[model samples]
Target: MNMEFTPDQLQRYHRQMILRELGAAGQQKISDAKVFIAGAGGLGSPAGYYLAAAGIGTLAIADNDLVELSNLQRQIAHNTERIGMLKSDSAQSTFKALNPEVNIISITQRIIAENVAELIRDFDIVVDCTDNFAVRYLLNDACVLMNKPLVSGAVAGFKGHLTTIIPGQGHCFRCIFEEMPPDAEEPSCRQAGVLGAFAGVIGAMQAMEVLKLVTGAGEPLKNTLLIYDGLKSEFRRVNAPRNKDCPVCGDDPYITIPGC
Candidate 1:
């Protein structure tokens, strides 16, 4: 084992460090990684919590929305007292409390195309916990252009799905969903009514994927879409192969711009 980890850190992560796949070396990789999470709502909550507890070196959470009373249903990072606070700020506070060793950066600004590249430029990995399709596409394109790995998760009603996208190695988000669905076609969580615990399930999985990516512990979900059906209590993995014709990560591409 390396002498870099403090006695407290080694004890705190003793259980994980004992795992055959992730020993002290893997833990060191995790401690040196910088992760960017693009939301602080349901999906972001558990994802951030687990990553913080796992001792991610630096975590940056970005969200422009304010916590509403309804958000408490699944947004575990924020409590009733923080109902009106910015989601990013609330998540930072919660993550900091979970692991004071983690460097948490709270960004309360919207992640528009104009600033997406700059926001993620310094990070080693990006986690897509955003709710909408527009920001998803924005993140997908930006990650592809920047050659960053992205752990994407989404939940709606009793269903949730997750996938890991590595720039050149696998399919990008556009390969699976060609274009953003019309707003009317896709109902927001408000209309569909998400199950709180279901979001936690997928969010925790996202964190696991990040850990795998960081430490090279095991195979990640790259080019695979993991689906969860809470009502039926089933989990499915679907093959999501790369599209050679994909605009973002294809041979003859079109979306060469980082955040367009």
Candidate 2:
């Protein structure tokens, strides 16, 4: 790839370029990559912000939610002034403000059985910032089917887990857990109650994973899961092996549908 950066881009990303791992070439990789972030809430907030500031070429945010007063506690993308606006709309505005040079695509729709594949087909990476297991599973299955990499993270209260899913290369989300929670609920940062700073920390980690995946700077979080306990300021990594009997990606697949 004949990748070159203009004077303006160099000036804008000088700090990022100074990092030995993220030279002009890596920056160009980021500049040419498209990322699909599946939420505009807490995790998605900082993930999208940093990616935009780092100059990801295009960020497609899919969120069929609206900004509410309660989201202000953890979802840094939306503010009091943005109340009543769609979450995607609020996030797109924030992203543009951070770096107008970054292209933003806002899909104010839910990721459902009918359209998840189309949303991620063109993106270089997909970030699972959504709060529920259903959306997480959907994204996992879609990415696995399409052979795309997915950066997955979730925060409930002061604890969170982050993992990278590379289908056929490593364990998928389904490989870890067989089925969704029996009593599934619409993921609400409101009801679950998350520590604000913990959300920022996890979200920022998610952004770093995205950069690493795009720039090829380090070993991406594949075949393992990182867990954080904000209450004690402790962190740990655990092995995540792909199960041969995994319903979605295993030898004998249970769920099969086109364009999941």
Candidate 3:
């Protein structure tokens, strides 16, 4: 890896570069990292923003939905002027503007089993920023099958949580939650409004985890789930063990595709 930084690049990331853990070498790794984010909503907005600012070389954001007025409450990457615009397009514009050094790929399509592999195959990291459990499970199984690192985050009302999965190093999402919860059991942001800026807190944490993963700095939440409670202003970490019987990451794997 060349890992050379131009004068402009050096100045752009001077703050992070000065850190002993992530000097120019770490910045170079970040500059070479490719990240695939599955949604451009609340969590994705802030998570993608920090990644862009950190100058991740290639950032591909996938979203089939259009920006809505309701999304403005937490999806900070999109503004009032961009209402009705495709979420991926909106995120592309925002991230590109924030850091022209980043090459942003905006995919305006829903991720399906047929295409999810190719969608995230080339990326170094896969971020689960989608809202619903279906998309969550789809990304989890796909990443496990593909052996890609996954940084998953979720928020409902005033609570949010995140976990990192490095294949064979720790518990996979399926290991912790074997099956998607019943639809009626899932509390969505739409039904239970997320606290404003709370997504920022959680999303920023997600971004930090990504940075750690790329730069090889601090811990990356492997085998542990971190939960945040906005109302109580509390953060907790719980061990998540890999289930030997996990269908996706187990000895006899089962899930070969999405929705299977």
Candidate with best lDDT = 1
Error of 2 at 18 (Å): 1.7
Per-residue alpha-carbon lDDT of model 3 for 1-260, expressed as tens digits? 56788999989999999999999889989988999998999999999999999999999999999999989988999999999999999999999999999999999878887788878889999999988788888899888878889999988888888999998887899998898877734538878788659988988888999999999998889999988999999999999988889999987887788422
TM-score of model 1 vs. true structure: 0.96
Worst 10 residues of 3 by lDDT: 181-190
* Model 2: colliding residue pairs: none
Instruction: Give the per-residue Cα lDDT of candidate 3 at 74.
Output: 89
lDDT of the candidates, in the order given: 0.91, 0.90, 0.90
- lDDT tens readout by residue for model 2, 122-194: 9989999999878998899889888899999999878899999988898999898778887667675556689
Model 1 CA deviation exceeding 4 Å by range: 1-3, 184-187, 258-260
lDDT of 2 at 49: 92
TM-score per candidate, in order?
0.96, 0.97, 0.96
The list of candidate 3 runs beyond 4 A from truth reads 184-187, 258-260
Query: Highest TM-score, which number?
Result: 2
